[model samples]
Target: MMREILYRLKDRYHFGTPTFQRDDLCFVTVKRDELRAILTELRDVEGFTHLTLLTAVDWLEERLFQLTYLINNREANLTLGLRVMLEREDEPGATTGDTIHDLWPTAATYQRELNEMFGINFPGSPRVDEEFILEGWTDLPPYRRDFDSLAYSQQTYNDLPGRKTHDPRDHMKKALYPTYLKEAE
Candidate 1:
């Protein structure tokens, strides 16, 4: 019965049904626009009251990121994945995110983090322009694979100002410390 309701949105929405599940509650994937509708149905009709988690995965090599919403059916107390596959674009201006904050109040913070860390824009989400992580970042997002965390560290950070870049292992060598050669002695 619930599946039939969601099937109606098939043509109107773009989402993927996860192949794996362990319960009676069907896991149907729905688009961001349809997500509002589907989540409304779950809360008002099917009784999915808990939002377990919101997460994003970087597919930098593939030029995309996978966003996942873990929803639990309160009536049946079953968990299912609502996944959205977003293709990353070279043009940051073209990369826009969806807002699901209305469905879950807690989602606002998660959306903000995603925005700052990934440089994706979530339309209609409040305070997304505010920074929660990566203070004062001026370049491309640091989380993306192409961003180069090591290079950013080199450019933005200095190794204790003047401390020699010595390998700790060198200190343990017999030539450097006779006490370190106790085993060989």
Candidate 2:
């Protein structure tokens, strides 16, 4: 039953590609416009009513964000992974983002999280601007593949106020024996 829908997704949407990478999982890709329909059918028709998780992947050089929504229908013991991409263009951004809050109320939280973490706004998913996970962030979306976490850690986050830090590897001998100015093998 659900397999037909999966195939229709490929035939219906242009960018609705599927990654048959592994037998256990298949990700169905769809456009922003088609997301609502695809997700609705997956839930109402196929019984995939549970939204498992929502996350975004950053393809830095391509300047695209991949948003993934996982649905698990325990009754059928099946999972459907829906993915969509948002590209940053040179022109002005549109406020109409694909939202599934109408179909799955729980989707609101995921949408909100994506808005804050990836800077991918959900146009009309009530309280879209609400923040939950990260607070006091004034920089680029940290979860995007482009946002270098290590660099941010080095720059924005400092370990201590002004501690003279030593390399743990170099201090290994000292760490091994507090007094063991002992033997070296």
The digit string of per-residue lDDT tens for model 2 on 1-185 reads 35665765556555555665454456777777777777777788777888888877767688677888888878866677888778853222232257788887888988888787777777888888866787777766776666678888899776888889888876986887756565543
Model 2: lDDT to the true structure: 0.72
* CA shift of 40, model 2, Å: 1.2
Residue-level lDDT of model 1, residues 47-93, one tens digit each, is 66778777777787888877777877766656667777687887553
TM-score to native of every candidate shown = 0.70, 0.72
Candidate with best lDDT: 2
The backbone clash count of each candidate, in order, is 0, 1
Cα lDDT of candidate 1 equals 0.72
Model 1 stretches with alpha carbons more than 4 Å out: 1-17, 21-29, 160-185
lDDT of all predictions: 0.72, 0.72
